[model samples]
Target: MTSFLERARSDIGTAPIAALNVGARRFSAHRDHAVEAFPAMDDMRDRAREIRLHTLANLDRYLAQFADTLEAAGGDVFFAADAREANDYVVQLARARGVQHIVKSKSMLTEELRLNDALEAEGMEVVETDLGELIVQLAKDRPSHIIAPVLHKTRFEVGALFEEKLGVPYTDDPIELNSIARRHLRPLFLTADMGISGVNVAVAQTGSICIVTNEGNGRLTTTAPRIHVAMLGAERLVPSIGDMSVILEVLARSATGQKLSVYTNVLTGPRRPGEPDGPDELHVVIVDNGRSKVLEGQGSEILACIRCGACLNVCPVYRTVGGHAYGSTYPGPVGSVLTPALFDLDEWSDLPYASTLCGACLEVCPVRIDIPRLLLGQRRLSVQTRTGPMWMRRPLRAYASAATHPRRFRALLRIGAAIGRLFRSGWILRLPWRGAAWTQGRDLQTPAKSFHRRWKGRNRGS
Candidate 1:
């Protein structure tokens, strides 16, 4: 199985950031925004963490209550056991309606389940409504950041993508570029047969799904279409609207440094006869995918994540490789635990190790998830499964044996030091096979001979 980093290295390099007009400086802007947003992000993350932790600790009551509230409000709710099951439920609904077009607001869970691909396979044209997501979709690319899909790209790059893909007059100016996207997506909103949205927070008491965005596109997508299908991870649940308010406070602040997003939409069932705008049919697909496994395991905190991208901004590894390097829709420290815990472990085993075990992600996490702790635990599991390089096993086994027999370990170290003195230098003269992978991008500076050996020789000469 390939490590997550290795896979990321391959995919992110190849994926489109700024196809034509977009430039690499998209990453620099993301860094600037993150720094500017830090204060609010911190406060929001703390609030979000507390709310999720509180809810998770008492999940059963909340889940049952939330389901009841949604149904009572006239919304149809379907709980799916996994990704395929969730897609099947949505597909079945879409097919039953005999509609093909789908316009979706940005939702990472949708990407995780590859919902657009599934819908497209059945001949539906899935339109992305978020600006950044729209850019990536136009470029035929995957998202690179949690909040900003095209974070690794710049305005000029987006301008280029628009020129080539959208066939518009080419200009890299931000306002013109945004206007172009707005024009492009305008028709799809009205023409789409159904709207698909990702729920940000699910209120257990009222059975409402709250979606926040800067653009009003979310409202349009949920309203214009006759049928609206909302796909949400099961973790979105909160016991009450009041609790949702707290999470929302943190969510907006952490995600964009705003006290609140430009739009915070709370939608219950379908539109009542008197309602001005809303779908006639509202179907909520509560997707468990692999989330239940986390709920049942040591990863319950990971589910506490509200999809805020604060962790991404604060992560060093993320800063270096950007989101694509994680090779999962979710990136940064959050991806380290989430991708593996929710998906294939063997395929994603390297994600946890991609970190320097830095606490930046945790520090910025709205829900204050112990990300580094969880990442290390996942790493241990990977090692136990022998999912990584073979050489790790040899030293690990030797270390274990050493701990069991102290004297033997000491003697081995002494002997090794004696040998090291013969060819010791700042740079490694020779390396054991196990250490070769380390030399790929670095020169390992060798340690000096044991101080005790040098001391004994000096005393005899004196």
Candidate 2:
């Protein structure tokens, strides 16, 4: 199996790398400008963080309240402990409802659960309606960015993909490309029996689910089908609409630099008696999928994330290597802390190190999650569990030993400087062990002399 460093190296100097740079820079600029324009940005971020903290602290009460309110309003609420349960419930519901045709908006939960694959295995024709998601689906590829799924692919690449997959006239124009996608997906939405979506915020007070998006697909997916399934992460809840409003405010500015998304559809229940365009049956799936464990752990603060993707845009590591290198559903500074907390620490140990811990992510986050601290926490856990790579142990131990003694520390530094001087190229191209990982992407400049030596020489001369 290829390592994260290996995958990251492959993307460097490639078209995808260029695309990542452009996309990240554009989004980051938009966020900065939006925040600059809004004088209440700081206050809103603080409020949003407080709301998230309160909700997480009392998640059980809110979850129960949300479920009770939704159920009382003729909507079915299912609490899923894991992915298997969530997928099984959705699949069984589809089968029972005779839902052979399914259309979905951009749903990160569904992606995390691999819902499309599961439904497809049961002979359902699952179609993605979001433009970026459609492109990803047609190409059988994963989303590279959380909000902008196809940020890694250039327009030309998308044009080519559409041309090959949809058998359409090749055009790279953004407007024309969107038109083509709309032309293809509109019919599917009209004919789909079920529509699946991700809930951005669930209001426990009113039992309403808020869907935020830039495209019309979110609305169409929810209203177009007879059966609408909204997947809500157990942690994505607020006590009331007022709290939801604060979250939405920061989410839009942080995500796309808008005061509001083009569509912020809040659906309380299934169609009312007089409603013309609405789903006949609304099902809310509250998915745990290890989130409860995350809430109890050192990384509990991560549940406060609003999926704004602000961290990704401002993150240097994410900008450099892009999302696919992380090999997880989520990516960037948020993912570094989240993936390991949600999944296996040993398996995803590399994710925590993906960051430079530069604190760029914390600066941009809407909920103010301390991602660097959480990353360090994960690293500490990995070491305690002996899950970190064996190569790292000895070096760390040697450093720890030397750090406690001045003479040994100086001796080690002198030896390192002497070895560094042996390299004539002025840079160490390759390191002997785990240091090879560091040298892979950048050159380590050779040290001419240790700081101790220079200090001693100056003192003696003086």
Candidate 3:
């Protein structure tokens, strides 16, 4: 198994540059539109932050209120502690309903749970209705980016994928490709036994599940089947409609530069008796999946994310290596802080180090999440808890000890300069022990002298 850094280095070469160019261009448009649309963008973000903070602080009360209201409106609510529980609940529900096929909208929560795989394991065919998701699904690939699941695939690649998987004549034209997908998926929508979706914002006051999408799949997924299941992170809730509106204002602008997404559906319950369409049964599964634990520690601030994917688009590292490099459901800056927080730190310790800490992610984030600070905190926790490699910990500790003592520090600096001089070629080809890993892709040049020493000599000469 290749490591995260190794895989990232490989992808930097194999991933298409055109895909990255498209993402960059789209993100630039989003940034420009956000500036023009909201002159008080900063103020709006501050308010959004306040809303998240308040909602999280009172999350328990709000969750209870949401459940009671949803149940009163004839919807069943289930709280899942982890991925297994969430998957089991959905699978059991499908089994009870004898659901043979499921049509799904774009939902990162479902990805996090690996719900489709679970459902498939239980012998049900699941279809992804979102265009990007459909492409990835047809190719048997995982989503590479949060918002654009196929952001790393070019039109040519998608055309090939469609041809191979759907048996449609290959054409790289965007309009024709969309027409082909719509034609292929229409029957699935009409015949699906169940529909699964992800909730963007769950309004506690009104018991509403809100979803924002550029495509109409969300509406179809929720209404076309006899049973509708919507999954959401427990933290993805707002206290009232007013707070939801504030978030919506920033979400669309930050995500895709649209003043608002093409579709924003707010469903209060399943179909009512008088309703002409919608599922007969509605189930809302609120998944914790280690999020509550994040709230209990220094990582709680990460819950402020609205899943805009702005941080990913602006991150230099993500742009270079793409999302598959992280090897997690969420990728890029938010993923760096989030994966470790929501999962085992020892297993994912490498993710937190995958940033330049340039603060670009912070600048672009609509909710003002301090991603760099959180990443640093994760590093501190890893070292303090001895979860990091022993070799790394020993060197870091030695460096810290020496730097605290001026005499020792100066002596080490002189030794380093001497070593550099010994390497007459100017570059250190290899480092001893774990330090060797740092030079795998690039050479490290030995410093001729410390900056402090150079500055001291200049001052004396003057």
Candidate 4:
């Protein structure tokens, strides 16, 4: 398999990278404007953070309350320990119900579980109802970003994809593209036997799970199908409706700068007596999938992420390489901390190093996750475990030694300055040995005189 860095390097100046840059910048600007417009933004963010941390701390109690409430309201709750258990529960439910077609409403949890592949293996046709998800599904591509699944693709690329996949005339117009998707998905929604969605925030008090979306697919997916299975992460819960509302206040503004999403559906359970449109059976798969381990570990606060994708919009690395480069279900600054914390650190050690430690993600995060601190923690863990890049070890060891001793540091600085002065151009075209990678893209500047030398010279004259 290709490495994360390799994938990122390959897409540097590609069309997808260009598209990602434009979309991320637009979303970042909108979020800034939205935050500026909201008078209580800072206070709301503080409240949201408090709510998130509080809920996580008491997650066990809330999960039990939520399950009991939902189960009493004619819904079933399955606590899955991992991906296999989660997929098996959903597949078994489909089999028992004789479900032939499943329409999904952009559930990242399902993506993480690779639910579609599992269902397809069981001989069921699963369709993505969200427009971005539908486009990626049709193109047989994975989601690049959390909120905007196809952030890497431009309209022209989407048009081409639709034309080839749906046999429609190629049109780069977004309106026409949406129309094509709507026409194609309407029949599927009506025909699908099951609907799967990811929960934004679940209210333990009312047993209601919120699904925020920009399109009507969320509603259709939940209502049109006879069975609605919500793939909910265990951490995505609030103590009450008020807590859920507080999270909603920041989610949309941080995500797309909207006061609220176009469709914020709160479903308590299956259709009640005389309900007009809703599924007959409601299943909530409370997937743990390493979350329990995460909750017990150093990076537990990462579970507080609401999947707003605001951090991705502001991250310089994410903006340049897009989501595919991260090579995980989640990407960007949050992903750098999350993927490693939730999975094997040895495999994902490179992710934490991808950042510039600029703290842009924290600045834009609605819940104030302090992603940079988490990232540094991950990097520290990687080195402690000896799972980080082997090449960096020697250099960092040397740095540590020199930095701890003032005399050695000064001597190294003098040597560096002497080497720098050897080049009259004031720029090193390439560094020796392993450092060639550093100057490959741009030349390294010559080092100026050390501060110690300047201070000493001025003092001598005095």
Candidate 5:
């Protein structure tokens, strides 16, 4: 119900346009060319799905390999079973190193767990360095979309959010806005004690962590701090950098319609003895949370998600209601299936039903995840258990009985239609609770008897 999520307001200071630029680019790109734009990239979705399924099947093996290689590369690797445990590990490490200021790249896993809020609650000054995330952080707004956090904000709205929240002189020019953001965050990037980033892919063989971003903040976030920490969902691991290449090939093109992000950094470990610029200490947090559980269940197909946000771009429901209506950190169709599978289904019962059973999410999925199937699965589970509403359950049963029972159902439908014919002045259902709600607003013509009745009548030559 809150318009914005609770994050530090000081984070987006003076750079409201950063939000607008990131948000605008996503909306505009999708607006102009979404379903039609990525025709060439469709096969990549199948490839990505195969690779993810393969990796998940061999997850334990791949995980061990990833951690061992990181250890071999002088990177400390810690595996936490859940979000609380994962953030605790990072906080303890930061406190041990006497770290105060923290800068972070965009990471959805953190947002899912509200990790930044947890860190801030512990009195750590955590800053989101991604331009969109930075704007949302300053505006105290939850991300409207995963890939682009401020996707719902218009430039004018962003300018106003900046002026009202950041005390910046309001301006809407894209170039002017970007300059202000860069100028404002330049100092924070340099001064931060440790940097946190999300891993796009973790190469098990090379022990390298990869990140892709349009802005250079990810580079600054990972390298500038003395200590660098990267947290990833356990599913993010790929077998090797070779496997990583296939994902990267599809990730950007599917996500932003670009061949590559402006910054694609692969970090192996701590700064080598002779290396000029890198973190002195590198720590990788592999958080299982509910992902291990996710990989085990029918809903596991969601794990194949590479988070391109193409699903959001094409979903009619997502476009209409937006992400906030989903009421989870992860929203849209992916969120509809994922959040409940990973968390409590009861808490998110409304979410699964929020969809129109549309297949747009699956169509645009770079991994070819059958999102609509999973959503329907969730709905069936919820409905069977009465986790949904009495209103739905009662009417659906009556409808089901009527459809399944032939003669009785047809007779009842005929009676209902005959009664409805009273309101039909020239087939216009212009009647003013129950059926009137449909009739009063629009033309609700009663069917000319039941289809089965008509079929029987025609068969008998009645």
Candidate 6:
């Protein structure tokens, strides 16, 4: 199999730069609008960070409180230790309930767990309701971005996909495409036996699951089906309604720049006796799936992420290569840290080096997660554990040795300059040994004189 970096290189050609450019422009405009809408945005972010830190510190207490409160409200709470357990529990529940169809909203956790495949393996029809998700599902493609699953697709491509898959007449008109999708999904929403969603924030105070979306699909997914199941990472908890409000205030601004998503559903339990509409049965699955392991270490700060996708939008690497390039469910800076920390460090060691340590992700994060710091930590751990590529070890050691000694560094630079002089065009097209890999797609511009030598000469002349 190709490595993540290799795959990313292959995917850059397929990623629609025009679509990405438009999306970036819209994202910037919305973020600006959000900043103008909320004068206390900084304070809200600070409060949100504090709340997340406090909740994570006492996560056990909040989780227990949330489960107790949820059970008291007549909702069943299941604690899944991993993806298999979570998928099995849901599958068993579906089997017992004789569920034939499942209507799902946009839920990255379900994607992470590959729940759709698991359910389909058990012979159940699964439909994605979110517009972006539906597009990807119909095209049989993975989401290219967290917030905008099909951000890499153009309207024309989508029209073509609809024509090919849904047997609809090809038209790039957004309204007509939406109308076609709605016509197809409305019946699924009405007849599906179960609804599955991912929680944006789980409030411990009221034991309510809050999900934010720009479409009515979230509400329809939860309310229209007889059985509703909300899956959440254990770290998605907030201490109170106030904290949730604080986080919510920043989430929309950072995510898509809206003051609030068009629909924010806070479902506490199944339909109450006197309620006009809701699922007859509600289930909340709290998944650990290596999150508890992440909490026990230095990268625990990553658990504070609100999944706003602001990091993805601002990350130069993500923007250039797209989300599919990351080769993880959660892509971008957050994924760079979380994938290695939660999964195999040896396998995902390259992910840590995928960033330029730009710090833009940390600055844009709604909850103020120190993503660059965590990424640095992962890189350090990779070095200390010798989990990174073996070829890098010798070069890094030589660089470190030479860097610590002035005379050796100066000699190395003089030698490097001499080697540069040997090249006619002043560009080293290929380097020897491990450096060859670095120069494969990049040309090294060898300066005529080292910076140190130039600085000394200037000082003498002055």
Candidate 2 local distance difference test against the native: 0.91
List, residue by residue over 57-88, the lDDT tens digit for candidate 4: 99999999999999989999999999999999
Which of the numbered candidates is closest to the native, going by highest lDDT? 4
Q: What is the descending lDDT order? A: 4, 2, 3, 6, 5, 1
Residue 7, model 4, lDDT:
89
Model 6 worst lDDT window (10 residues): 13-22
The candidate that wins on TM-score is 4
Query: Model 3 residue 272 lDDT?
Result: 91
Please give, for residues 1-462, the per-residue lDDT of candidate 2 as tens digits: 555777888886788878988998999999999999999999999999999999999999999999999988889999999999999999999999999999999989998898888999999999988898998888888888989999989999999999998999999999999999999989999999999999999999989999998999999999989999999999999999999999999999999899999999999999989889899999999999999999988789999999999999988888888899988999888888888899888888778878898999998998899999998998898889978755466778888899999999989887887787689788888897768878987889887665877799889957
What shift in Å separates residue 205 of candidate 3 from its native position after superposition?
0.3
List lDDT for all candidates, in order: 0.79, 0.91, 0.90, 0.92, 0.80, 0.90
Task: Report the CA-based lDDT of candidate 3 relative to the real structure.
Answer: 0.90
Per-residue lDDT tens digits for candidate 5, residues 161-184, read 777876789998778777777887
Lowest lDDT block of 10, candidate 5: 2-11
- The parts of candidate 5 lying over 4 Å away from their true place are 1-40, 400-411, 419-449, 455-462
The TM-score of candidate 6 is 0.92
User: Every model's Cα RMSD, please?
Assistant: 4.0, 2.5, 2.9, 2.0, 5.3, 2.8
On TM-score, who's better, 5 or 6?
6
Better of 4 and 6 by lDDT: 4
Question: On a 0 to 1 TM-score scale, where does candidate 4 land against the true structure?
Answer: 0.95
The CA lDDT at 285 in model 3 is 97
Tens digit per residue, CA lDDT, model 1, 1-462? 555556555644343422311332333344346547565555655666777888888877887788788788888888888888888888888888888788999888889888888888898788999998998888887787887788766777888888999899889899898888889889999988899989899888898999888898999999999999898788888888888888877776667656678989999899998888889988988888887788888877899988878777667667666677777888878988898998877777667788888687776566888999998899888887888444356778888898789898889887777666666466764466756756765677756656886799889957
